[model samples]
Target: MPPQVVEAMQRPMVPHRGPEFSEFYIALIERLKRLHRTEAEVLLWPGSGSAGWEIAAVNLLEPGDVVVAGVTGDFGDRFALVASTFGADVRRVELEWGNAIVPERLDAALRAAPGAKAVLLTHNETSTAVTNPLAELTAVAQEHGALVLVDAVSSAGGIPIEFDAWDVDYLFSGSQKAWMCPPGVAIVVAGRRAWERTRETGTHRFFWDMDRNLEMTKKGWTPTTPPISLLYALDAATAMIEEEGLEAVFDRHRRLGDMTRAGLGQLGLRLLADDAYASNTVTAFFPPDGVEARTIIDRMASEFGITLAGGQAHLASSLIRIGHMGWVDDEDIESCLTALNDVLESV
Candidate 1:
């Protein structure tokens, strides 16, 4: 976390229902709107990004509603599972773990399940380190008359996402990723179409009710007691993003991604994600033949004090992920790569 964000969180708490809190909450929402590039109602929930998926599913889907989910990685599969748990007939467009979902494949799935209520997408799959073609995929889903629900948990503030331009029905992200804040808050943006669907869905909801949340939002408050400290951190982090400029922040991530990928390649390691659709926030790659992913991760941490994430599920033994998103710079990537190279050499 940034120094300002830490300082903001350390400040004394205020009354959640008071006028001072309302003003602060309203101002933060406005900044979040600018960040998302949307005029839709942006809600901050006291939950993780995964909770946003369930909130969206229950509010927008009726039991037995058909959903076309693109299963490109662990997170994508989890979103599909959430929708199915809420009673949606999730028809997954399954892909290999390291591959991205192409528009043609998604279009075929939507056509196969005609009249599907919605399409679930992960904007950037951290588990696979692939950024799906969101705009093109959204167009395809909309053409099939399906609403687009996106999980931008790992890509929201780092990568370029124009929610209004894409006409996304619903999109949600976390405060911990590219927002440069501690975890706790789930940021959700609901478009006009999604709000209309929420009114018609037969699914039951209370704490996650969008309608009730919308009412409280009008009064500049949350339905439940808010996470005030996390909110303070978010406010400070968002200000830093604005001061540095969103485009500049995105450019830095892109440069770091390029540097990391090139360094890994020069070290004789193979990248898991295709170069055509690599993620700017995280990069996944395989260790050299004879070296285990665990060996590299453990050595990098114990020897260099640089923590790296291992792959998820089936890819756990073979894949490793390097995050280069919020609060990271060129030198950070360089140091990580140097340590990784040393680890590989010794192994």
Candidate 2:
């Protein structure tokens, strides 16, 4: 958690149903809307980022509906799995792990799948560190008369995403990632069209129902026991972001990303993704020859007290990931890189 966000969570708890909480809730919603770059209602949920997938799936998709899913990495694959679990006929437009999901493939898939209800895209695939071209994909989805849904868990505040400008119908993110808050809360933004589609769907939903969540939001409260402390942390984190200005925050991430990637290149590491689609929040790279990713990760944490992430699943032993988002500074990146260089030499 960010320092200010941790401090905010330490404040004495307030009754979640009262006017005091109502003001806090409303203010948080406004901040979330600003972060989302949308005028749509932003729904808050006391759940992990994975819940965002379930909520979006249950709300907008009914059994037997066709959906065009763009899968570039693990999270993208998860979205497709969620859609399939909901009984949607998912046409998966897959790409190599390090590659971005281009609009042409999605347009082709959506065109072939007549009456497709939605096109699911992962804005930033954290696993592979590839950021998809959201604007172009959203335009293609619209051209094919499909609702655009995005999982922006790792990129929302770390990079600039114009939700309204892209006409995105449904998008969700986690508070723990770019929001610079702790886990346990997720934000979901639904455009009017998405809400209408939810109403038309016959999917049985209780806790994740958008209609109920919207009504409670209008009343400035939640239907169930909310995670008040996490909300406070989110409020504080968002305040800091707003104070610094969103554009400035994005530019900071962009600079940090470039610096980190250049430093990695200087160390003779192989990046997972191409320069055009590399993510600003996280970078995945192959270890130097004869050095395993686990060897570097373990040595970094055990010796230097710096932790690095290994690739997921089959790529686990093949590559390493370094995160440079959410309150990270140049000094932090430099220290990590220095430690990484030491680890490489030791290996």
Candidate 3:
């Protein structure tokens, strides 16, 4: 951990209702608003990114109520499953595993489900390494009067998400991704439309409660005990992002993607996604001829001290994904590429 972050966590514990804790909580929320670029309410939940998933479902979805979503990859499919657990009639407009949800299909699905309450989509499908055009697809959702909930866990901060400009109803992200911090803190940013819908929601939730989160935050604190250490870490991460400037951070990730793509292209490796739809944080590549991806990733980690990630499901044997979101630079990219080349030669 960084020195400043260690110091923040080492500070004396304050009562949940104490003046110090209250002040810090309020200040932290304000900082998040600036970082998220939203005038909407930002709720910090004390669990992983999936906790925000449940919160969104409970707060907006109801049993038997029809919900429509674009299933571009595993994240979107899992998000629909969670919402369906709330008893919502989840309808999916699925694309092939390697492709994104086309805007035309998204619009058609909304029109098909006339009374749909919300439409779920992953802003960036980490499984397939692709970024969706939220701006265009949200326009289709807004036209149908359905609230848009985006899974931006791997996309937010690593890329640009225009919350206010796009009129996104609800957006969720976590600190583990581009925020460059440890996990355990998930954020939910909701616009007034989604908050208003909460009055009619009957999904029944407590710890991951959003309505009470809004109410208790009146005093600048959570309704229950919070994760004090992770909270401190999140604040420090936000400060680090601010110091780097958001555009510069985005550019760094973009350059990483560009360089990785170039390197993989030079290596004659097959990319899983098209250039236009590729994710800035993760890039998936099919191993070169006569080479197994798992072997390359394993050897890179064990022999060269270079840890890399393999693809999911069908692409596991063939593809390896390079995650270069936070705490990564050109040198790290070079190291991964060099080690991958060496591993392929050895294999």
Model 1 RMSD, rounded to 1 decimal: 0.7
Residues 156-250, candidate 2, lDDT per residue (tens digit)? 88888988998999999988999998999978999989988987988789999999999999999997888999999999999999999999999
Residues 1-347 of candidate 1 have per-residue lDDT tens digits of 78999999998999999999999999999999999999999999999888888988889998899999999999999999999988899999999987999999998898899889999999999999999999999999889989999999999999999999999999999999999999999999999999999989977799899999989988999999999999999999999999999999999999988999999899988999989999999999998888889999999999999989999999988889999989999999999998987888788
Report the error of model 3 at residue 207, Å: 1.5
Error of 1 at 302 (Å): 0.8
lDDT of 3 by residue, 1-347 (tens): 34566576666777878889889999888888887788889889788887767888888888988889788777888899998988889998887766777678898898889989899989998888898889999999999999999999998878888899999999998878887777888888999899889988876688877888989886788977888878887888788777889889899999999999899898888898877788889898887777778888889889998777887766667778889897788998998888888877778
Clashing pairs in 1: none
Q: List TM-score per model, in order.
A: 0.99, 0.99, 0.96
Report every candidate's CA lDDT: 0.93, 0.91, 0.85
User: Which has the higher lDDT value, candidate number 1 or candidate number 3?
Assistant: 1
In model 1, what lDDT does residue 73 have?
95
lDDT, residue 125, model 2: 93
Question: What is the lDDT for 262 in model 1?
Answer: 95
In the predicted model 2, the residue pairs found to clash are: none
Per candidate, the number of residue pairs that clash is 0, 0, 0
Q: Model 2, stretches more than 4 Å misplaced?
A: none
